[model samples]
Target chain A: MAGFFAFLGDVGRALWGAWTFDTSMAQWFGSHPDALAISATVAVLAGASTLLGNSVVLFLNRVKGWRFALSLLLNGLGFVLLYLTQAVIVIAVGQLATGRTVAWETVVEAVMLATAPLVFGFFELVPYLGPGIAKLLQAWGVAALLVIVQVVYSTSWWQAVWITGIAWGVMQLVSWALAKPLAALGAWFWRLISGKPVLLRPQDVLSGHQFMPVEFDFQLEPGEAGR
Target chain B: MIVSLLALLVVVVLLFLAVGPLEALGWWRAEGADEAVTTLAEIRAAHESVPEPVPYSHYVVYLSGIGAIDGTSIPEEEQPLIEHLRGHLPGFAVLNDVFPYAPDNRGLTAARPMARMWSWIEKARFANPEALVAMLVNARNAIQLFVCADRRYGPTYNIGTAQAILHSLFRAGYQLGSDVPVTLVGWSGGGQIALGASWYLGRAGIPLTVVSLGGMLSDDYGIDELQHLWHFRGSNDGLEKLGGVLFAGRWPGAVGSPWSRGLKEGRISVYELGPMQHNVTRHYFDTKTFAPDGRSYLEVSAEAIEAVLLGTEPKVIPVEK
Candidate 1:
């Protein structure tokens, strides 16, 4: 009952905020006219970007399973790489200075911006290269694949490489975050569907043991030894 | 556990429904609207009283706040104050056009066919102006009466209703004369409108003199070119603190009292009135800063209008206490 009230309180606050938002905003805009349009636009874009990025992580987790850890590592590394890309130094000493200090969000943004073009190009150039390139020369097949993938997707060159690296990173890190939660949910759902007498516990499943273990009958052996 | 969770969710939803929507609606409705409408009707009636009207010395242009329409939503007690300005300000003309000077209300309605038509016209009035006497009265009404009742604060606290008001006045100026002066008397949110108008108009090579009462003018007013600015504060009012924030944030390097901060060197004037509440017209009039003793905001602002337009020192009359 207490938890239910807490949930109700949260909902009420959110709704009230939304409802009052317009009038309160209108009044604010009335005072600070110049900043209204720009601020609203920035806020909207930020929210949309965050939501889209989270969805992509969920989608990739379903496909790669445990390999999602690679996605997480790559995502983290991509951020670090982008941060390093900003400061080009003599003798490449800045590379050593770059560490985990770079935020994951910034890396995600870089990957999103960079990978957007590659995804667009793959669908566009693949069909044209398939038949036309085959007739031109079977020996140049490897070259043709490179041309379609690299030429169209790799337009900006360095930035594209950086972005693709980040995209690769996002895929891996998201897989890592989702892996444990997804597995737990999966077990819960399986127990619900199969009507098994087992508790929906991921730890027990991983350990290969029953949640409620039974005692062994070693008492009879002790009495026989005494006789 | 499942039942508890579900029950908890239901209760949470019910509480939200009970409070959230209602709070939103209450704040939205708190905007003091009828005052503008009442004031407009009174002006219309006052205009009817003139047997043979003279071409106004300047246009008494009033801008409404965010949520309500000016002239149309003014309260009854305040009607005479605006009417006196409409009837008395020498060379003043009353515009029949409802510029939808308020953006939210700038839409098609039975009474307002030209709701936002002023936006286009304001552009045309860049060079011409007979003169403009504007009242930044709407914002005060909305904030002090409407938003204040809800006790909610947000970014909206920073917005000013002056931009739209200025745009309309600029258009009106274009229709009148190129070298005309604009006198503004703004209260609360209307004060912001006045500040923005003066800033924009001053930059355009037109002269603007604004006298604000308990308004929200911050140094942020982009009025480096304004000829003159006057600021007034009711000592006891709560809005002074917030308005100062805008002044500090927007106008980083301004000097002088709050009123004179954006004015040219030696052009700014500051007036500190005795401690009073919002809508203290009587106190303002008795202080001899306003035209008629114990008059409404519209009448008092109009008196200041005559001062700016005629370019003379205001006459002082002792109130018979």
Candidate 2:
């Protein structure tokens, strides 16, 4: 009952805010009523789609013998935690010198850029080198990133925003770099742990396709190191 | 091991073929009929003007359903039934003559990418400007355009369907009267056509009522935004049981099932118009029942129109399976 009422209250507030938004409503309804209808319909449909999609997932969970309430509760709380984490990050950073707090975004950007090469280097390692060891190296790489950011101080809000934006852009490029190597590492780890030869290439694994190996030439002799 | 891997690869290929390209092929093969493009200005010049007003609370738009052949027009038999409905609407003007039995020009196929598909399909399907004028001979014939579709079923088509119909209607020079709301009346595949068009029309800024008889509206397209979306199906019609996920004998997803959870959170109303096979007029006209099996399109449409006029939110009525 309380949740229902709270939902109603939030809906009422949102509706009130939308209605009272003086600038666009009059112009939109008067000049382009069809656009207004279309926009409202799109928003409503989008929201409904989200709800329907989630419900389907929940139905699958039920088939797996999980309680529906548990799924709902976990999803609901997960969203709350995500919002809280973002809020804390923003508020804590906001307290820093306005431009200084912007460093967090910078840090994220840098981490994204460096991630790919580091993962690739980790994948190049022999089977004995576990991902845990690689992860430690990644942590070190991120720490080194902070020092790099501190050296090039952001002077203004616009500069910080630009830096953040650039870092984000770099992050995307880094993700592409890391993707193949990470798959290699995963394949190696799976083979080592499962006691089987990893035959599939990283690309095949990602594309959800089967990998077929061709014949390999081998020259075998005892004590080959001497030869 | 080799055979197993080969089999696995084959199955994967088959899955892609069945779920992906084949669906696209259906849309491609079901290309919009090469109908001439008709506009409102043309319909207006030819339309028979109405001198007096009658007491109709809403106007119904009927789109022609799909034809397996490309250049087929609305069958001659279906014409009289359409004419009868218009004739009965008291002061209602029949808009069908303005939109004669023309081919759909919308370029629709299943496999096309989503963003560009709808716009292209609508453009391809809308009637030519010449056709519009010949159809709208007078105001008595100008109540609203009616149309339908064949072969295609499901909620996703709702967007393209809506785009084409609304595009045609507006292009026909018919402005929805502020005093009289628009309603959609469709049969069989026409049901899906009406539902799809109404969905987009509502989105594209038309406030209207949609009542589909034996239409294929899967739960995937959220019908909650409709002023009223009544699905009238017969117990024997075998359409109501369809959930829109089956393609070449496979489920697209759990959510595609109409009975799937959370699929019915909006104003979509479902009623079993039993013992009737896709006939809305014959079933409901004389007796107010949609068919002898006892379904009522008029009653459902009326309730929906009442809600719209009163600006009241419809109460969700859960159908007992």
Candidate 3:
């Protein structure tokens, strides 16, 4: 239990570092022997938080039993892959723009730490304001990532912004290119787990039972007729 | 120490906020399905002796505020107002046995894990004179109100609530697609619940009108489906004002929102009652407090509602900024 609390403390500090744009924490993580392990934990925490945050969709779709468990696992895997892709793009763009040979481990660490604000991702479950909260968290993560890039790559604010912007554009193109194949793969996996094709639209997921007004058959009991 | 305390407070608040969505989704899935269905069936069964298609031209469903524990638990102070409305409106059937907090109309003490706690709180509410216990009751129901207004959870919650209302109306001999206008009189948090359920109710073909009495409502799309909305607020009611402050769609700058459209198209009307508080000590239903015109506050409110229902326009007093 003590060890678990310690682990939580470490994660919290890493997140706080990202929030405050503290350069020393980034530098320490970049060179620490256990940097990879620490980064992996942060990524896993992020993925878990994101999965919990998005569980509403699965609940809304009424995914049940093994399908529900499998959907969560699949979502977690998707989050990891998305983080890896973003990290790799940032590294590529940072090196090209700054002419600096930054370590991939350092870039990955920065990226994972940047997503620490998403620890509050479950807040997306909040009514009326949930979507707005999600957007605010995303913007916070992006800003953290920008600051991390500047510190890690030893670049000016303009250079970091340019690199981040370019990386984002490249990430979008890659996503667009891989969208079809990724979707097919996801569908195939969903079929294997749930024995059905994936529901692609919100309405399709919501197409189950709806509450309709029932006409009451008001027949009286024998003793209650005169009352 | 204060920082830690503040952090803890935030976590508590976040946890509290999370419960509303979770409870709503639970209801949508399987939490109260059997109970809701059984309750509806029982309501119909109870009304078995009433003549089929009982002759009432219009129906008024009164949704009570956050302080309610069950359909029958209309606060003693507010009972006279319900009685007044019924007495004044000749051809209208007024029903108040619908609890706005739960989609299934289940009371807080109704067969749940936390039923004992809520039951205790309710007992304490009457036993103790302190307002704290009552606030707890309000807090719990207020979360449900937020769930009803929430985009992600609102549809499911509203659908369930609409089902409850529809069944209640059915038991009242409301014919489906009968074009008999159903007026929803929602007090406080019940106002938002009324608006949220209006969409599904409208789709079911009941001509709908909503009267929000000091209701803290949202800028819901249900405004588009309403025949008209008459929102009443007391001059001293800051809680009701919070609706306009909190909902971006209610702002004048949000021209594209349904509420803005409703305002522009004249489907919604806002009226001010003089110096009425939201609810509690000196609220809308407080009969002991007399206005300058030698009438009780309850009478004034009931008269305004009566005017709206009778299609006789009441004096329009602009709300003070």
Candidate 4:
């Protein structure tokens, strides 16, 4: 119990320090590998927590047999994808964009450590304030990430933002390109494996709602004009 | 040095914000209308080899919606469509037309902001012109072949799509109810283009039956020119149903037009699938279709076309999932 409180206290302090952009936290992580590991692990856990429970439950239940395995594999793949994207690929992009060299370890460590604010996601269940707080914390985490990257990459504040911003744009482009194909592929795989295709919502048509707010004075459909 | 570099970056971002940097850079512009015409001409030229001695009783063309190539790269939506047609419609020679402009989806943003941005310009329905221009580059005209149907994603591009369809039939030695009756089936935006084909190609003296599967409606002049229009809509395809209602003149009102009037006059047949969707591929093709012989919407549609062409009831009974 005491150890748990100690861990919580340490996490709280680190998160507060990150929110404040305190350089001492960065210095401490640079000197103390164990603290860095522990905190980074916590951050990873926090990140993974978003996906962990549902995936674990689905896997254990053997939903569609191979489907469960695919889901679990995808969960792990998601982590690795984020890590490679942020830690390796985005950092490389940052280097190219900013003309500054940041050690791989620095990016990896800062990324994991910068996830401090995500630990507060538990408060997301709070009514009204919960979702708002969650979003604010996420935004705060982004700011914290920019600060950490600036400090560890040893780039000017603007340069850090630029690198991360450029990386973000790249991510957007990549996601735009791959989203449909990946979705189609995944849908295909699921159908092939489970023998059930993606279902269309009955509500989609039944909504009976027009996309436009104004009722057209003109008739678009055959019988709609009379109505 | 950093200050200048930073200034340059800001300028680039502002430029991007102004003209949809990706569009300005032509990242999404895979092929132009000319390429579509060239591809069609090539395929039409290729059809001369060992042609069927007797003319094909029917010439059927399939054009799929946004983000797909109609030919070999036909996406899941129309893969089953082609398969079913092949098995069922032995009298018809199935042809796929590749329309450029709307290419495959490969960008990072899942939102498909470009499609939305361009949609505003095509429809000329803009609540936020500034935002639309920023995303669509303020250039509303120009259709991407891979994109779904719209008022004018690229109005001229539809002409290319229409040209390819028309030439393919002409080269295949087929005509309207003489050499062979033509049936054009379009899925999603392809449906809109299919209607546009009737409007455009009909003007050029080519007439064909159009089969639309959850297709967006158009307000072009030639919508009334097509002899028969079969529209297969899924009950759950709310987004597509919204298309008719969203457009100003296309929606319900006086002076009944093609999209509105054809249904009233029996020129357009509406087949409302029991549990269908905006996508026949996802709901029917990916999974097995309701038809025992793998006949989903298109196979059933093939029957409908046969009835129109040969004076028989299509008996297109929807198998609700």
TM-score against native, each model: 0.38, 0.34, 0.87, 0.40
True C-alpha contacts between chains kept, each model in order = 0.00, 0.00, 0.30, 0.00
Instruction: Rank the models by TM-score, top first.
Output: 3, 4, 1, 2
* B286 Cα displacement, candidate 4 (Å): 4.9
Off by over 4 Å in 3: A1-5, A172-227, B1-4, B31-52, B315-321
Chain A TM-score of model 1 comes to 0.24
lDDT of 4 by residue, B270-300 (tens): 7764455554343423354565556564555
Q: 2 or 4, which is superior by lDDT?
A: 4
- How high a TM-score does candidate 1 get? 0.38
Local lDDT at B159 for model 1: 19
Per-model TM-score (chain A alone): 0.24, 0.28, 0.80, 0.64
- Error in Å for residue A110 of model 4: 48
**Candidate 3, residue A45: how far the Cα is off, in Å:** 1.6
Worst 10 residues of 4 chain B by lDDT: B138-147
In order, candidate lDDTs are 0.37, 0.37, 0.77, 0.53
- TM (B chain), model 1: 0.50
lDDT of 1 at A69: 44
Candidate 3: interface RMSD equals 9.0
